[model samples]
Target chain A: GDKVKQSPSALSLQEGTNSALRCNFSIAATTVQWFLQNPRGSLINLFYLVPGTKENGRLKSAFDSKESYSTLHIRDAQLEDSGTYFCAAEDSNYQLIWGSGTKLIIKP
Target chain B: GGIITQTPKFLIGQEGQKLTLKCQQNFNHDTMYWYRQDSGKGLRLIYYSITENDLQKGDLSEGYDASREKKSSFSLTVTSAQKNEMAVFLCASSIRTGAGQNTLYFGAGTRLSVL
Candidate 1:
């Protein structure tokens, strides 16, 4: 079963544009985390949230545990932002489930 | 400001052959994990350790063996490689916040292919 489902499996953005990626959880998530997998295959943590929202430079992430959903917003997309974005949900039982991921391609 | 090092960035093995992957972390964290990522799919946990000698099996632990002999190092062994199997194995470590909540620091990943 897919506990964590991500939308827009693939996305393309022009330079200087914006986009949003989403993840919906079927289970009760107590915390959420977002990561970016770069071309070098390194998984970098972008945001770790308990609830509410957080903004890090051009990237902003929001998690609503009550609604069982989370979102990541990218502002002024740059070529360096071209990578795969993933969101993972953590339940009270300590189970961490991941979404399939959204592959974002930033074009020139 | 520490990094996770995964040895043999790329691995090639024959069917039915035993293979091993190694990971080393310098963050002195208390928790470590192993995950497998297939093409177009999310990562699946294979193993995790809470401390130097505690090992826990994950959802995808079949056909895999793990060891946490030392606090800074963890190793995974493939019981028997399956033909045509290809996947990327990621190693990560984290400082326990509470219960199981953590922000992971990952290695560059080990790309494996079976012949």
Candidate 2:
């Protein structure tokens, strides 16, 4: 079984629309981190959570360690938001287990 | 306000050739990591160093080697390149806080091609 799994492997949305990405952890997760790998291939850190929800601008993320899952919601999506989103979970050993990723395309 | 720099943004090597990728971080982070990303796949940890002169093997460290002689730099070496191998190597750094993990800052990445 996958230690970390991401759903909706690919998503397409219109600008100004909304969408959500999810990650399921089979291992015991203590913390979660979300990152966006842009078209240029540079990864940008989006949110880091510890069993709670966090919001930054149009992006919001929540981590439910007890349930072993996390969610990233994008509100009012923009073209620049088009990229691959990755979620990583920190296990008890403090090692990060990564998800395959979700490829997002926001069309204008 | 710091940046992680990976040298030789691109690399091409022949089969069985030994190639090295270098990373430097100005963040002065205590922990640095090397991850390999395959097309449409997730990042796999290769090696990580929690401090200078220390190394920890990740799940995918089998065919690779890593060095961290200085606090500001960490490097990964491919012992022997495989023919038709292609992947992106990413370097990241983060400060360890208390007993948990912190946010990570990654470099642009080094794309490798083996012929």
Candidate 3:
């Protein structure tokens, strides 16, 4: 069984549209982190949450430790937002359990 | 803002050859980690260091060695490269915010291919 499961293995959306990505965890996660891996393979940190919601620019993220899930929402998606999104949960042991990731393509 | 730098953006090796990857961080983070990502797959941890001279093995630690000789640098060595093996090696560093909680920042990654 996967400790961390991500939804919508792939997603394609038009520019300026809004969409959401999610991660469900079967482990006891204490914290969660979201990242976007650019085409060049550089991972850009999006948010770090501790059982709450955070918003930055056009991105918003929320983590509910009790519910064992996390969500990332993108508003007015831009072409530069096309990339792979990954979320990792820090377990009780402090080990990061990673999700398979969601490949997002923003079409013009 | 700080950065994490991984050397040799690309690496090619022969089967059974020993290969090494290096990472340097300017964030002054106390913890560093190494992860391997195969094509179309999630990342698997290789090794992590909490501090200088302190090493911890992750699930995929077998056949790999790591060193944290200095606070700002961590390195990973593949004992024996497998033919046709291909993966991206990522290096990350994090600072602890609270008890058992951390946020990781990663480098551009190193692409490895073995022939």
Candidate 4:
């Protein structure tokens, strides 16, 4: 189990409120990538889905390869948008399955 | 718009010694990766290469030892060093792989400390 599963491991938002981040794939994923591990750790590269949806400025993403799951949405919530939030998946032999993050904390 | 240089961002080994980590990429990517972040646990894919010298082995890849030698460089070696062995070693690059182009470009990690 847990080929890739991320959820409210941590989140605090406030600045402008509105948040959502998730990833759930047990395999069979086609493609999904979303990252943002700022806070000096640098790992930025949000959204790279394949199933559908994709935005930018305020962030918005969604990928549902037959419900394998994948979603990340955050609007207005700034403070530089906090940190930690990863979701990676790419099965079908492409390999790449990682999810154990979601620590955003945009206060003030 | 390409830069993935990771080297001694901070690394200190001792326990058993033998450590080496270095990655350089100026785009010219062909596929290169080596992840291993272990705090909250997630990124794990010991090695990968798809061009110069090619070599692939993920899922932790044993004691670890990788080298791509060319195409912009990629090297990782930590044969021993294991004593608490803190983690944080990520180096990625993608520009040639199947579908979607496997977009991945990261490098700003290499915080190992195994005193």
Candidate 5:
């Protein structure tokens, strides 16, 4: 009965491979946001979605409230992208529920 | 084009002692929030303020107190430093445009140590 669940808790990839991280929610999510916690422990906002898809550079994300899931795809992974990725969902009451996170390590 | 700064990046206290963490934002946002993050657990909201003098408790508000003394600053106090709750505390802020919730920005976070 997890409100927000993230799959593949941890991931390891070669420098140039691609991968996808997923989040499934039981709550009626109104919005979704993706974040990256870098090695220095800085929580950097990567993407914000309402109900569709968005692409920023090599990072792309999609949120489908109808299906109760979200996805973040990383293309051509690099050493700098080695960090933890988290997805947070906002409900109708304007409260956020966070996914545990996906620890990604892009090996050189 | 703003920054959220959390003071005393690291906090250490004796068990059952009172500890305080401070957050200041230059974005002049309307909403501010406090969240606690454990090692493997995701971030959990503790408190939030919509306006200058308003305060609302989040899911994990127990044993924690927060203050929105002004529009630019918010402070959180640990009623009693317990070893179980020793983790990183994150402070964030966002502007509510009335249309919807805007992007939430977070600080570097403060790591707490209970001795």
Candidate 6:
């Protein structure tokens, strides 16, 4: 079984729309980090959470340690938001377990 | 903000040849990592260093050697390139985690091709 699993392997959203991405962890994760890999292959850090929620501009993320899951929500999606999203969890040993990833395409 | 620099944005090598990749970070972070990403696959950890002169093997450490010669730099060497092998190697660094919470800063990555 995968230690970290991301939902909706791919997503398509219209500009100005809102959508959510999710990641579930099978291990006892202590912290979680989300990243967006742009077309240029640069992985931009989005959020780092520990059993709580954090918001940045048009993005919001939440991590639930007890439930072993994390969610990333995008508001007012734009063309530039198109890319692959990844969520990684840090376990007790301080090692990261990454999800396969979700490819998102925001159409204009 | 600090930056992580990876040398040789692209690398081409022959089968059985040993290739080396270098990473330098200006963040002065204590932990550095190396990950391999194949086309359409998730990133897999190859090796990590907690401090200078320290090395830890990850799940995919076989055939790979890593060294942390200094606090600001880490290097990885592929003992032998396999024919038709292709992948992107990513380098990342993070602050020491005493509370178990730290975010990783990544470099642009180095694409490797073996003929």
For every candidate in turn, the CA RMSD to the true structure comes to 1.3, 1.0, 1.2, 14.2, 1.2, 1.0
Least accurate 10 contiguous residues by lDDT in model 1 chain B: B95-104
Please give, for every candidate in the order listed, the TM-score of chain B alone compared with the true chain B.
0.95, 0.96, 0.96, 0.32, 0.94, 0.96
Best-fitting candidate, measured by lDDT?
2
Best by DockQ: 2
Model 2 regions lying over 4 Å from their true place: B98-101
Q: Which scores greater on lDDT, model 2 or model 6?
A: 2
Count clashes in each candidate, considering only residues at least 3 apart in sequence or on different chains.
0, 0, 0, 0, 0, 0
**Which segments of model 6 are wrong by more than 4 Å?**
B97-100
Expressed as tens digits, the lDDT of each residue in B1-110 for candidate 3 is 99999998999999999999999999999999999999888899999999999999999999999999899999999999999999999999998865655779898899
For all the predictions, what are the DockQ values? 0.84, 0.87, 0.79, 0.29, 0.77, 0.79
Angstrom error at residue A66, model 2? 1.6
The regions of model 1 sitting more than 4 angstroms off are: B98-101
Q: Sorted on DockQ, highest at the top, how do the candidates line up?
A: 2, 1, 3, 6, 5, 4
Per-residue accuracy of model 4 over B17-69 as CA lDDT, tens digit each: 88999999999989899999987666889999988999999989999899999
- Per-residue lDDT tens digits for candidate 5, residues A54-85, read 99999999999999999999999999999899
Model 4 scores a TM of 0.33
Q: Each prediction's TM-score against the native?
A: 0.97, 0.98, 0.97, 0.33, 0.97, 0.98
Clashing pairs in 1: none
Provide the fnat value for model 2, as a fraction from 0 to 1.
0.96
Docking class of 1: high
* i-RMS of candidate 3: 1.2
List runs of model 5 lying over 4 Å from the truth: B98-101
Q: Write the per-residue lDDT of candidate 4 for residues A26-98, one digit (tens) a residue.
A: 8899888999898888898887888999999898898989988988999989899898999999899888888
Candidate 3 CAPRI assessment class: medium
Chain A TM-scores in order: 0.98, 0.98, 0.98, 0.35, 0.98, 0.98
